[model samples]
Structure formats: structure tokens, C-alpha cells
Target: MSTAHNAFPSQSATGAERGALRGALRGARAYWEMQKRCAIIAGSVNVLMLVVFHIAGLDALALFSVGSIAAYALAWLCLQRRHNRLAIGLMCAETVTHAGFGFLLAGPESGSHYYLLLFFPALFLGSSPRRAMLPAAAVLAAYVALDAWVYAFGPMALISPFDQALMRHFNSAIIIGMLSYLAIYYRKRVVSSERQLRAWAGSDPLTGLANRRHMDATIRALDADRRGGELAVLMADIDHFKSINDRFGHEGGDMVLRRVAEVIQGCVRDTDHVARWGGEEFLIILSATPLHQAAETAERIRRAVERIAFDELSCEGAPLRVTLTLGVAERAGQEALQATIRKADEYLYAGKHGGRNRVCRHADDPGRRALRQG
Candidate 1:
């Protein structure tokens, strides 16, 4: 591996942090699955309870109304653990159910007021913050209205048992809001850690470019139609790069390489990608640009590197400069990824043989006019 200094931010975490993140990512998947199965079971139980309560009739409505919350809670718990897009079904159904339940125990003394406490956890388990807050707030607003219209004040104030329960219900909503905030923060951390691990798996330690393994994956992604742009590839090698290590030491050579990689990345578009292709060679992919355009782009990178002065780069020694030779090609006619790569490789070698530090598009083609440009 080259000892180049990369500009990419380092994401190495403490041992405990790394282990915790991996465990969380893996565990979350299983938890979601478990929650989903449990939800189905809970839904079944709730259906049974609702049926029994409905059959009994009369004031049974007040007693059985809480069952709606219970049933919906199960569904929310199940969805919170997975990628189910319809998780909001839980919120929608639950909210409407709560509103119906609210209107049912209309007495100034109805218990429907306290039932609102359940909304907090429901909100916590709800599919999204907005979904959670809306229902909870609506229920709170309903209570505010009920508080003014309840009968405990006897025809003057219509306060009922349900309306009286509003304070406790609102408290529960606050708790759910707190818990949801914490959960969201935890999720953000989990996602950030996973992103770091992904970067480590695919990036070069020295240059921050995609490692060869990642390049392979990128090629697959390109062919799978994952990327929308036309595919162009480049293979580049440093000109007489080894001599720097021979003259100043490997550390100095490393500094030079890091600088070159930066220059290359800077010259490329955000849509384009570059990877360390092992040793002193690099691979680049330019998106949305065709072959002839790719050649021009590659040359632009070449010229950018040609301008970097490495002699000032120092580590217990004078600085150094680096130059590169690049081979350019496109997937215009080739259907297979390997064929496209081979074509670029052929040109890469051609650039090497034609003279170091010049960009070459193809064999028999007039290449860079600069005198070895390095």
C-alpha cells in the first residue's frame, strides 16, 4: 500500500464505539423483524377484545375504547423496527380511533380524557415526528375544548371525568415527545456510524479514493444501470514516482502521492469518481461524459497535476513534485465491464511506453504534446 497522506477526514472510532455501532446496525434489523411478528399477534389479540366488548353493548363502549389504543400500539411497535412505509397506517387509524373514542364518552366525567395519556407512547412509536406530534397535539386541543365544556362545573362548565383526565394525558404526551427525541438522536448516531464503516470498507486508507474493491463494485453498479451517466474510465500512473522514494525516502514519496490525488480529485466533477488502483496507479470514472469528452477530462486532470510543485512538500526534507501519465477509454462499444477495463488498461500501458508523464487516448493516436510533461 502507498503511504500517501489523504485529505479525506479520518473516521476511525474508538474500539467500544465501533463494536457498539456494528451491534446496533445488526441488532436493529432483527428487532424490526421481531416487532413486526409481535405486532401481528397483538393485532389479533386486539381484534378479539374489540369483538367481545362490542358484543356486550351499552356503556361497554367507554370500557372497550382503550382497546383501540392498545391495538394500534402493537402495530406501531412492529413498524418502528422495520422499513415499512405504511407505518403511518398505525397513526392514521389510531388518531381517528382516538377522536371517535373522545366523542363517545361525552359526559363531563368520561374517562376518555385520561386515555389521551396513551398518545405519548403512540406518538413515540409513531412512524414520524410529524405524525406523532399532530395527533398528540390534536388530542390536547380537544381536551382544552372539553375542559371548558364539562358538567362538573354543572351546565356552567361542562367538565366530565374524561375532560378532568386531560392533565394526566397531556403529561404522557410530553413524555412521549421526550422519548421520541432521544430515539431520533440515537438513530442519527447509528446511521452515522454505519456510514463510517461503509467508507472504511470501500476507501483507500492513504488517498481517500475508492479502493480497488470499491472500484469493482462501482463498475457493477454502473453496469446494473445504477448510475445514470455514460461510463468513461481512466488508468493513471505516476511518472518516475519511485525515484522520489529512492532519493528522499518513502515518506516523501507518500506526501507527493497524496498531493497528486488531491489535484486529481479537485479537477474532476462531483459526479465523477476516482479510486486508488493499487501501487502508484489510479482509476477514475467520469459520469455523464462520453469517450472523447472523457479524454479531454482526463487531460485536464493531467494538466492540473503537471502544475503542482512537489518540491515544497516536506517532511524532514525538501519538498518534491509529481507528474502522471494517464490512459483514457470509454464503454462506448463494449458490453462487458472487463472488456471496457482492458481497453483502458491497454491505453494505460501505451501511455507508459510512448514516454512517461503524457496522456494517451489510444494506440496509434497522437498523445500529449508536452515533453514528458513531468
Candidate 2:
């Protein structure tokens, strides 16, 4: 298996999922850009705060204001380095220092005076909800402890006592709101987007079944753990499809292929997948069904295709008939997925040779069993 970080960025958004894809990228980029902006905003906020502290001759507050400016610059550098861990680490460090400095320089009268809310939006993106709360709660508790420590310390003059209590309450409300909004809205959107992307990667657009790539991926991904169902694979091809194209043109051929796709879909259970393997050929992945059952299913699709009538074409001065030939084999534990597909394709060719519109077993072709599917 490839590493998680490497493969995902190359994935394309399906037509249905463009909105979610845009939203995820936009949110992440906006969050990064916002981090960069925070340096300027926090620095300005600190400079203004320094002017106020200088008037009051609160030298410690001025010291903290300068420290905050330095921390913001360090934070900016961390983000630019693409060191996500270090960047978040800097943010956490700054959160602690700002809260502590507030308590040290001001007192409980100021509480956690350094805008604690600034970090919460970014936190919503970084970690899972269960894990995020741990960090957020840690930050909040640090602020509370610092406030308590300040209250126990010597006299200090800053915000009125009533204003301090009100600020602390407001901080608590904002934190709670952040938690609620992220859990209900942002997280749901992320999950929905992920599901849609998975479906896009897994499905064949023409027939709404697993694509060839998806079948290969799925085969490699199945675990060696307990499995109750027997496995069977069927490789199917539309009989005389090329002649149909020559006789009725490509559009009719496409229509016939589509109708055959519907017929194949109708023949199998929802659990099974019938993929358009390529032009006029399909790959059917079966679960719970053994070789014989898979063969029967393939025959059902064959008969369905043979019986389908393109009546609208009759009205248009031309009609078409389509039929399918299939090859079925059980998935042996010793055989790889591609190898099985090759085996099925050999039997499928045998069916076409012997007489189109029949099911053949790969074991019938002792010579071609070792051959590859093209």
C-alpha cells in the first residue's frame, strides 16, 4: 500500500464532488493564509496594547506585548517552513505564553486577555473532534489556572472586576459555540466529501459499477481475515459487438452496450458489481456466489441481452439486437486478481470461437489458462 500523504493529492474530483473538493481546499488554504495574516494582526494588536501599558507604566505588560510580537514572527516562520507540527506547536506555545503573560502583568481583572478565540477556528481543522477537545481544554484550563494565580497574587489595576468576570464568561461561551459549530457543520461536510470521493474512485461512469482500476485496488486491499462468502469472477463480452458498430453505426453500438449494461445490472444482486471492463466487455465481481452460481448469473445476463429489443430504433428505420458471451471462474486463494481475469478472458475467447453467446470455464482451455487478459 502507498503512504497516505502521497496518493491523495493526485486524486481528481468527480463531477458530482467539485463543490466539496473546492470547499476543502479553500478552507485549508484560507486557514493557512489566515495564519499568515494573524502575524500582522496580532503584532498590531500588541503594539496598540503596548501604548496603553506604557501610559499606565505597566512595564510587565509592555514586556509581554513585545514577547507576543516576537512569538507571532516565529509562528509565521514555522508556517512558511511547511512544518505543520512545528507551526501548531508554536501556536500552542503562544497560547500558553499569552494567557500566562496576561495573568502575570494584569491579574484576574484582565483574565485571559490575549484573544484566545483566534486559535479555535484553526483547531477545528487540525485534529479529530475527540482529540481536539483535549488540546482546547488544556488551553482553557491553563488560562483558568493563570487567572486563579493572578487573583491570589498582589494588587494590580486594569479592567474593572465586573468586566473581567464578563470577559471570562464570554470566552467560555465562544469556546462552546466553536465546538458545537465544528461538530455539527464542518465535520459533517468533511465526511460527506470523503465519501463522495471514494465513490467516484470506485465507480465506473458508463455503467455505475466498479471500474477496472477499482477492481484491482479492491482485490489488493481485501484482508486475510475471516470471510464467509465464496468468491467468483465473470468476464463478459458483447457478442458480435464490432459487427453491430459496422451495421448500425457507433451510436447504436453505444446504445446496445448501454442496454446490455442495464441487462447485466438487472441479472445480479446489489452486492455484486458488473463493470464495463472496456469496449464491449465487462468484469463482474461476485461475492457469496460460487463458480456455478456465477456461471448461472452470467447466463442470465446473456439471455437478457439476447432478448432485448431496440424498438425505438425500429421506428427510426433501423433496429438492433445485442447478445453477450461470458466466462466464469471461482477466485482461487492461490490466484491473483489479474491472473483470474486473464483466465476468464481465455475462456471468453473460447466461447466466442466455439459459438458466441455461451459461458465457458477457463479450465476448458489448458493452453490459454496461463495467458494474459488484454
Candidate 3:
């Protein structure tokens, strides 16, 4: 690989981060997986509550913890079966029921109402905001009703101040832990989404090379910062591409395009910018390189392409062969980048009209010279 600095940002990540991002990319299914994880966490919290309440001789609350754990297990099973809607509905039911129990029996100091807030963002995970609205409003209504009931009648059962405070802190920690996990999950999703958007915006879908728009941007950036070094551009076109498409069909044509892109990419240094400049044309930009070196690179690409045997894309009894016609141009002092590109295009056509599988570097390039002599 040529060790040239790339104009685009790298999308590399650690294995764990990549896994998280990949999970995020799965949309609703990923959300369901996240919901299952939430269920497991909440169940674990209920187990702890079950132990604490049982030890404290709070039989009602301890019995309620057992029921909550069972509900969470059911929700987890629903998620496992891919019944996301049912699973989320079950979770919502458990949240409201548990919150009501805590407020009515254990009192407001227990902080169980915070559990109601967990599903607000979670509601949007498996659904659109509009679809999630009613459920979210129901959660809000439940919270409001619980608050009003507590204001009027107060706690139905009284516990020691010490036990109340301990429960309050325990509930707070659980909710806080859940919220922190959600924040991290959402952040990973956003990062993964941005990376995908960037790739779709900048790359060609068929060839996986930089598209014309990206190449234009790279050219402008390079021109603005010439760094007192030479810049070379090569415009290449597959010889008789339309004929190939006619013979082999679009799928075969696509395979050829992808293969040619790979070969061209391999011929250039890592820092060099290569783009699919629409249809069968490709553009390359070499930084800190002079005309001769660029011409040599173009010749190398031409030879490489010419030797490509399409073993899998045979015509009759023989394998298919492909070739490239390339034009090389170096950016002149203070010359507009577009002008250099046009010069390259002109030379590319010169190579095309002269014969086919050759590289043209100048007005007096061998292909053009041969044509003139002819």
C-alpha cells in the first residue's frame, strides 16, 4: 500500500465499539435486544429488593418484588420470541404497577416513581415518536395520578425513617445506573449513524470508490494547500465498456467495474485519491508527485487492467480480458484545478481515439504521435 495520507477520515474502531455500533445499526431488533438487557437489569434489582424486604419483615413489598421479577422474566421471554410490542407493553405495565405499590405502601420516600421515566426514551426505541406518544402519555398520566393520590391520603403503611432512607437511596442508584446505560447506548448509536451517513455520502455504491462529488472536494482542498509540491491527475476509462455491458449484462458489467476499481486502487499509494467519476470513467489524484511518475502510474494501471482475466465472466470457451485508456496531466503553477482535469480528459480521449489500451501524458504522447504519423 502506498503510504500517502488519505483525504477522508478513518472509520476504524475497537472491537467492542464496533459490535455496539453494529448492534445499533440493526434498528428495532437492536432496540429489542437492549430492552431485554433492561429487563434483566430490572429483574436483578427486584431480586435485591426481594431480599431486603424479606429480611426487614416487609412481607407485602417482598411478595410484590417476587411478582415484579416474574413479570420482568415474562417480558424478557417476549423479547426473546421477537414480540417487541408485547414485551414493551408488559414492561410498561410492571413499571406503573411497581411505582403505585411503592408510593401507596412504602411511601414517596422510596423513589420508585423514577422507574416510570425509564420507558419514556425506551418507548421510542422500538417505534417512531408518534407511535410511542400514547404509551408515553399513559406513563405520564400514571405518575400524575400517583402524585395526587399520595398528596391526598399519604402512605398507607409507615416504616422507620432509616429503612425509608435506605430504600430511597437504593432505588435512586438503580434508576441512575439504568439512565447512565441508556445514555451510553444512545451515544454509540449516534456515532454509528454518523459514520454510515458519511460513507453513503462520499462513496460509490457499485464500485465502493470515492464518488465524483467527494473527488471534487478533495481536489479543491488540495489546490488550496498545494504545499509547494506538484500534483498529478489521471483520468481513465475502460475500453469498450458499453460493448462489455452488451455482451455480459449489467450484473457482469458491475462485477467488472468493481474488479477494475480494486486493481486501480491497488496501483496507487494509500495517500492518493481515487474516485469513480461517473459511468466507466475514473479519476486519480497523486500528491507530491511530478508528471513522469504520474504517467508511469497510469501506464502501470493500464497494463494491470489489460492483463485481468475474467475467469468467472467467460464468453463462450475463453475467459474475458479488459483494458484501460488513461490520460495523465500535472497541475501547472497557479492553474485552476478544473483546467488540469479538462487537460486530462482531452488526453484520455486522445488515447481512446489513437487505439485503446494505452496511457497519454501530453499532446505529443506516443498514442497521439502515432495517430499523427498515421
Measured against the true structure, the TM-scores of the candidates, in listed sequence, are: 0.52, 0.53, 0.83
Which wins on TM-score, candidate 2 or candidate 3? 3
Candidate 3's TM-score:
0.83
lDDT for 360 in candidate 3 is: 88
Candidate 2 matches the true fold with a TM-score of 0.53
**Higher-ranked by TM-score: 1 or 3:** 3
- Per-prediction count of colliding residue pairs? 22, 0, 3
Candidate ranking under lDDT, highest first, comes to 3, 2, 1
Best-matching candidate per lDDT? 3
User: Candidate 2 at 291: error in angstroms?
Assistant: 3.0
Tens-place lDDT per residue, model 3, 129-148, is: 99999988987888889888
Candidate 3: how many backbone clashes? 3
Which candidate do you rate higher for lDDT, 2 or 3? 3
Q: Is candidate 1 or candidate 3 better by lDDT?
A: 3
Minimum summed lDDT over a 10-residue window in model 2 is located at 1-10
| lDDT assessment of candidate 3 | 0.82
Candidates in order have lDDT scores of: 0.63, 0.67, 0.82
